[model samples]
Each structure stands twice: as C-alpha cells, then as structure tokens.
Target: MKKVSVIVPAYNAHDTLARCLGSLVNQTLQDIEIIVVNDASTDDTWEIMSRCEKQFPDKVIIIDGDRNRGAGGARNQALDLASGEYIGLVDSDDYVAPRMYELLYEKAKEGDYDIVDSGYYQEATDTARLYTGDDLTGILDDNKRKKTYCRRRISCYQSF
Candidate 1:
C-alpha cells in the first residue's frame, strides 16, 4: 500500500485549489496518494481537479460527486477508495509544507503510533496565527515545546 493517502474535499474552491494540489504533488515523501473529491461544486473546481489529474496522473485520484455531499460525505467517499497505510486529510484551500508528511510518517514509524499530529497557520490580510493540521503541531518549538493542545487534528492516521 502507499505510505499515506491524503484526502481533500473541495466545494467551490476555485481560487486556492491549484496551489494546494501543487504542494501535495511536490511533497517530500513521494509514496503518497492524493484523493480529491469535488462535492458538486458549481465553480471551476472540477476543471482544476481534472487538470491536476492530467498533470499527476499516477498520484492524484479524482472523485466527482453528482450532488452536494458536504465535506464529511465527500471525505467518506474518498475513504472508501483510499489504499494507503495511513490516511491524511487536507482542506482544498489549505497547502502544507513539503516536508510535513515526511516528518509525520517518520514519527509514526519511529514511535509505532497510530496517529501523528502537526501544526498549521491561519493567515489573514494582516494576521497569521498557529492553528492545526496532520502534524497537529501547535508546536511552538520542537526542542522546547512542553505540551501542545491545539486542534484535534492528525498529521496522518492508520486505517487499521
């Protein structure tokens, strides 16, 4: 199985979808699959997904919903097709660091943990705050961090 399968559910996210896919396509760990679900988007989301599929035909899997399934349902749909050892979730509007999965995967293997979490940032016009993601970090400092209780996010999770 692939090392990790990243699931992304898109709904009218035409603006940032391409950039998000670009980051995943360029992940440091290449043994991963990106499953993007288009939840009946009324915008150009489908077209962008299609283009990304063409560009990364082997790694990117496209799922088109006939009707609106919302984010949860879209994710569930992708979950059914995922064939990776670990599962990773990414919002269509969010882009991750290139080494994000590499670090998380390494942690999972080294610690023999079912889950690994990472930190993320919330960016606005003038403010950027640390938030959450697969690494589920909230990690202020890798060396000095004592405890991180941010969001209930996981960098990746094992299905079994």
Candidate 2:
C-alpha cells in the first residue's frame, strides 16, 4: 500500500497545475500516490493531467469528472478512492515543500497521532502561520491564545 495518498482538486487551474504536480512528483517521500481530480475544467487542465498521468503512470492517478464539481466535491471523490494509510488534501494552485509530507508522516508515526496539521505560507505574501490547537498555549498567553484560536480559518493542507 502507498504510504500517503495526496488528493489534488483542479478546476481551471491550468497555469499552476504543472507547478503543483511537479512539486508532488519530486517529493522526498517517494512512496506516495497522487490522485488528481479534474472538476470539469473548461481550459486545458485535463490535458495537463493526461500528460502527468502518462509521465508518472505509477505515481499519478487521473480522475475526470463529467460535471463541474467544486473543490470540496472533487476532494470527496478522491477520498473514496484513496488506498494509502494517510490522506492528504492539496489544491492544484498550491504546492508544498519537498519534505513536507516526509516530515509530517514521520512525526505522525513517531507520535502515533490520529491527525496531524501544520502551518502554511501564503504564496502571495510568503507568510507562514500555524493552526490554533493544543500547542497554542505555548506560543501565546491564555486570553490571547483563546482569541486567536477562535478566529481560525480553514487551511489548505492536512494529513491523517
């Protein structure tokens, strides 16, 4: 079985799709499978996915949807087909560090965590921010931590 199954939901993201897939294919964690879901893209996204499928036949799985499903729907579809021990969600417009999954998987195995989350950097601003969880107490005071935690936003990546 694959160690990780990364789900990529793509719409009209032809411009960034290649960069995103490139990052995944070059990950330090080689024992991973990338499931790319084309959510009825009107552009050449499907073609790019097709090429990736051919280029990395063993590592890439392409799923073409007949109708336009949103990103969440695409992720749901890929989730059903996932065969790895851990599931990862990524957007076609975003890419991760080469060692991101490798490090996350290692930490998860070491701690036997049910779910693991991490900080992300915005592509436009290059700012790294962490999610508010049990670890917040170490970084902020009680009152401030509570306020920051309450304003949590959905992040782009997760591993389980």
Candidate 3:
C-alpha cells in the first residue's frame, strides 16, 4: 500500500471542516497521514480540530499558526510536516469521494507518470461527462505551451 500525506489548510472553517475530515477518514486508502495547518482561525475551528485529534490520535497532526497565515503559508507548514512519498492537498471546505485517493494512486502507478493530472466532477446535480485526452493547443492563446506547462496551476480553484 502506498502511503500518502493529506495536507489541508484551514481558516475559520468550522462549518465545513468536519465534512472534509469525514471524507478523508473514510477514504479507502487507509495508510494516510493527515496534516492540518490551522491558519489562526478566530472561530471554533481549533476546538473541532482538537476533538478530531482526540478521535484519531494516531492519524491526525494539528499545526496551529500563531497569526493569520494565508493559504500558501499554511500549505508550506504542511509541506514541512509531510512524510509520504505522494502528497495531496485538499481545501478545508471541499470534500472528496472515499475512493478518490485510492483510484488516483492506482492510475499514477499504471500510467508510469511522475505526475498525473486527472479530471473530477463538479459534485453538483449535473450529469457526469467523461474527459478524453484532447489537443488543447489553440484552446487558450494566452501563453506559450512550454511556459504554461512549466508553471501550471496547482489548484483548479485558484489562479496561483
């Protein structure tokens, strides 16, 4: 089994943190270590995190920030604590399928790719659509392919 480090950066996310943690805890890939960077939330988020730590003592590690660090700062904290060969980043407000990591790990291994870029559904009531490989050379004439591929977007939600 492949070991994975699930890094989640949270800030005042009490409302959705539990749901996010729930999905992670229920993932089929059980050999995972969860690293949560609490970016100085002024809510009950830390309390919830403490409770989760108590529940999953061996699996959860909470890194509390003294001041408000942005998402990048928080993720950098997680990156420092991560120990797995494969790293996964998840937003505190977003939830994923239970088998998401398991399937992605398998796909990466089978494809023999150093990095695998997979598509995901919108999680709304919309019908599912398969994403076949397409030649998107002229799709966005914003920049050169070499540069675009070099500095690709890390998260689909954020341009950075």
Candidate 4:
C-alpha cells in the first residue's frame, strides 16, 4: 500500500491545476498516491488531469464527476477510493512544499497519532503568512482550536 493518499478536488481550475499537481508529483515522499477528482469542471481541468494521469501512470488516479459536486463531495469520492495508510487533502488551487508530506508522515508514524495536522502558509502576490496552531485559536472553531494547538506542540516537524 502507498504511504499516503493525497486527494485533490478540482473545479474550473485549469490555470492552477498543473502547478498543484506538479507539487504533489515532485514531493520528497515518493510512496504516495494522488487521487484527482474532476468536479465537472467547465474549463480544461479534465484535460489537465488526464495529462497528469498519463505522466504519472502509477501515482496518479483520475475520477470523473458526472455532476458538479462541491469540494466536499468530490473529496468524499476520493476518500472512498483511497488505499493509503494516511489521507492528505490539497485543493486544486493550492500547492505544498516538496517535503511537507514527508515530514508530516514521519511525525505521524513516530507519534502514532490518529490524526496529524500541519500549519499552513497563506500566500498573496507579495507576501505569505504562516499560521501555527497558537495563531489559530480565534480563527478555528472551539473543538478544532484545541486540537490544532495541541498537535503543534507534540510534533516537531515544520512545513513551508
């Protein structure tokens, strides 16, 4: 089985899909499976995914959405087909650092946590802001606020 399954939900995201998939394909963690769900995109998103499927025949899996299901539903479909020990979610418009999943998976295995969450960097045209768990107290809900805070303290890994 693959070490991790990364689910990507794409809508009318042709412009950003290539960059997103590029990040995943170049991840430092090679033992991963990428499941791309085309949520009935009106643009050329399906074509982009098809090309990626061909490029990474062993690592990429493409799923067609007959109707326009929102991101949540698309993710649910990929989740059903996931065959990895850990599941990772990445939006079609977003990309991660090369070592993000590698570091997170290492920590998860060491700690044996049921779930492992990482901090994120929100990027704009000129700047990017990093949000650690402590900074998420007010932003996340009460339940998530506590869990997010605790994970950062327990795990020593960091992501860009």
In order, what lDDT does every prediction score? 0.81, 0.86, 0.72, 0.81
Give model 4's clash tally. 0
Candidate 4 residues 12-118, lDDT tens each? 99789999999999999999999999999999999999999999998999999999889889999999889888898888888888998998899778867556666
The C-alpha TM-scores of every prediction are 0.80, 0.86, 0.78, 0.82
Q: Which stretches of candidate 3 lie above 4 Å from their native place?
A: 123-160
* Model 2 lDDT tens row, 10-75: 999889999999999999999999999999999999999999999999899999998888998999
Whole-model lDDT, candidate 3? 0.72
Q: Which candidate number has the best lDDT?
A: 2
Question: In model 4, what is the error at residue 156, expressed in angstroms?
Answer: 19
lDDT of 3 by residue, 1-160 (tens): 2277888889999898999888877889888878888999999989888888889976788989888889889989888888876788888887777788777667666755344444444555453333334443234445544544654433322101
Q: Give the TM-score of candidate 1.
A: 0.80
Candidate 2 has which clashing residue pairs, if any? none
Give the range where candidate 4 is weakest over 10 consecutive residues by summed lDDT. 151-160
**Pairs clashing within candidate 1:** 117-135, 117-136, 118-134, 118-135, 118-136, 118-137, 119-137, 134-154, 134-155, 135-155
Worst 10 residues of 2 by lDDT: 131-140
lDDT per residue (tens digit) for residues 1-160 in model 1: 9999999999999998998999999999989999999999999999999999999998999999999999889999999999888899898888888888888889888878676665455554343344433343333465323334433343222122
Candidate 4: global Cα-lDDT? 0.81
Report the C-alpha displacement of residue 151, candidate 1, in angstroms: 5.1
